[model samples]
Target chain A: MPSLPDMATPEAERLAQEAAQPADPHITDVALKPALFDWLCRMGDGALILGHRTSEWCGHGPALEEDIALANTALDLIGHAALWLELAAEVEAQGRTADDLAYLRDAMRFRNPQIVELPNGDIGRTLMREFLYDAWHYEMLLKLRDSSSPRVAEIAAKAGKEVAYQLDRASDLVIRLGDGTEESHARMQAALDHLWPYTGELFTDDAVDEAVAEAGIAPRASELQGPWDATLREVMGEATLTVPDRRADVHLGGKQGRHTEHLGYILAEMQFLQRAYPGAEW
Target chain B: MVTDTLPSTDTIRNWLGEVPDPEIPVISVTDLGIVRDISWQGDTLVVAVTPTYSGCPATAFINMEIEAKLRDKGIEDFRIERRLSPPWTSDWLTPEAREKLRAYGIAPPIDGTAPDGRTAARAARLAGRSNLAVDCPRCGSTDTEKVSQHGSTPCKAAYRCRDCLEPFDYFKCI
Candidate 1:
């Protein structure tokens, strides 16, 4: 048989567009503030890097369903990165599209944090990252829903539901592995220790966050931590895993455009198509 | 805001509901409650809606559907904007729509604990409602269990009915 793609691909793409664009502008002031734009860029940078890392597991996942799951999550995060980049473009007021921001930037220029670029070490590491990121995203969206900027709030409102589900999945896995067997629990704990430091950086403040919060575009990062803690505790307890002790070594500065060494390599692959074919459009 | 020889807002809104949700073909976007405000900005019929997820793959098709549906209705000059704040909640689901979703076998999302101090509304809603227990659509029994935290889609969960020994999908909230 010729394959389901013939039946599903076009329809899937069509559906994708429909669910994204609305018939009306939620917040019609087309102008994007520079600081807010930077914040968006920073956030996109993190998401896109994380997405690229996850996509590397396309054919390498332990199971078929899991392979698709990782790929799907990768697509969702990248798609979100693209949307945020589009918002950034508007803020720049330079007529740049999302493609321009995503494809044009060089490695050293990326603002994503170090955590996202870390190699997908093992299933344990992937689960660790997912647990942290999903919880962070869920809390952030909850705060974002009340954003002064109605546009951000709307995006959070819709995205929040999906994030919640993702978190639940990740949390379930964490619990299973932490309580599964000696080997799995050890691996999970190791992964947690390796990844925990990065969590602090996710909630760090920068000028963009300040401006965006002031503008009502989003909430302060500080406000998210309390809820994040509660959520993490709930999940950890269920998983029978002790939460990683709060680390003093805070990994900060991604929001300020500084990133780790791995970001360069990731960006090289991500931006290659765009840079090679300037102004390329599908 | 009536114009010369133009139809009323009510008529326009009714026509707009003709647009079906691109993913769930069984229901219209209006039925999903994603369609928020519908108004005219000049000749353009601007319809406001929120996506079910930030990175939902169906976004592209939803936009096309809206455009095609409106164009078919002889209205163009339309634009679809993605809204993020006051974020779309499952609580916005209409009772009629919820009933349809349940009949369709998709367990609708239970509302979140309100973050905006709307304890009164939440309390009122909780008080007035019962049957939060979801029935497995496949087996038509409330003795259903969540199989996995993740389902085939981001918005759904894998569920199995103990009574009927059938597995189904449940729509979940973030």
Candidate 2:
């Protein structure tokens, strides 16, 4: 309906190529395809939702430089989302396109972890949330470069380059702001403490994670925690910020399609055009 | 004689060499190395293009230009594929293209500093190391400082000449 390339014709040439190549045993298991699709959706959804939130700062950043930087980060995240979702659609072997998955899904159908969907409160809070998420995201991408699925590896490698820059910038700003004025420091600290509860959701693993881990498509989410912790310890140490004690996530379930009300509001604004006029294109 | 009407890959490549980047009109897309591979897929001409930045708005325009170029050559059966693996790097910019960028008042990406492959092996850059200096394209001053990591375009960084104090764009490495 969105003017997608016709994929209904199952060409014998492609079928023959698929039949001829020896499949990766981990991913070729037909039962695991659904799990893989879910896993890919989680990756793409996180990027998209967070990207939308970051873009909200487009004209509103505290300064010109900050505004431009935030916009660039948003663009990169949205770009990464497109790649991940396109691969997800391919893995599903359905007629759905990446645009369909991104624009048509309801709040309950999204697989992004809850941390990404929470509202961006203030500049300090936004930066604090960004720092925490960047650490985990970078670690996840680093490990994903070795994914058994070469396509996954390829995307990870590409996105990892960009995330490295994002993580570095976020860490630098967090340190500067957290150690700046007493007022700025207090606000940053408050942001870290407030956002800590949601951080756990990023590493919370489930049946989908188990499937992807077993299939070598991705590392178990928990495995990224150690690296995430090390990066956090280093960054927070320099920022003079105290990270809240690690605890089980009470604000969870986004990955499982149970999200905070914030996500519904976000989807309302994000999916408005697609919903208002189906198949609409600029 | 009739079968020889098909153009060679090199000829198609030359045709593409004439298409300038939408953002930087002075430089051709082929010189930027976004045009990755040209081959014949069955009877159709296949052109593989890569994006400089993941979210670059120019990609759609680039694709259209490539399609138009092919159409101009009477090749209607061509397919343009977006190739993502191996990733596009600033390192791929041609020597002549880099010179052109410099002359256009935008510093070319620092040679051999586009952040190497993978993170584990790239600790030095990942550790907040700066690229030392970006010479001002206007006054050719090595005393320039970075204004910001991002510039007007995603691929460029804002900078200013320390000597002339004039702002300029630096094509970012990576």
Question: What TM-score does model 2 achieve against the real structure?
Answer: 0.90
Model 2: CAPRI class: acceptable
lDDT tens digits, residue span B9-88, model 1: 67866776787776666667777777777766667555666666666667656766776676686664555545454455
lDDT of 2 at B147: 69
Off by over 4 Å in 2: A1-29, A246-248, B1-3, B115-131
Error in Å for residue A206 of model 1: 5.4
Please provide the root mean square deviation of candidate 1 (C-alpha atoms, Å): 6.9
Per residue, candidate 2 scores C-alpha lDDT tens digits across A80-136 of: 888888778877877677888988999888999998888899999999988888888
Candidate 2's displacement at residue A263, Å, is 0.5
Considering every candidate listed, which one attains the maximal lDDT? 2
Q: How well is each residue in B82-157 modelled by candidate 2, as lDDT tens digits?
A: 6767888888999999999999999998866654322422243355544447888888889887767778888888
Candidate 1 Cα misplacement greater than 4 A, ranges: A1-34, A58-60, A63-72, A143-151, A203-253, B1-4, B94-105, B108-132
Best by DockQ: 2
Query: What is the Å distance of residue A38 in model 2 from its true position?
Result: 0.9
DockQ of each candidate relative to the true complex: 0.19, 0.35
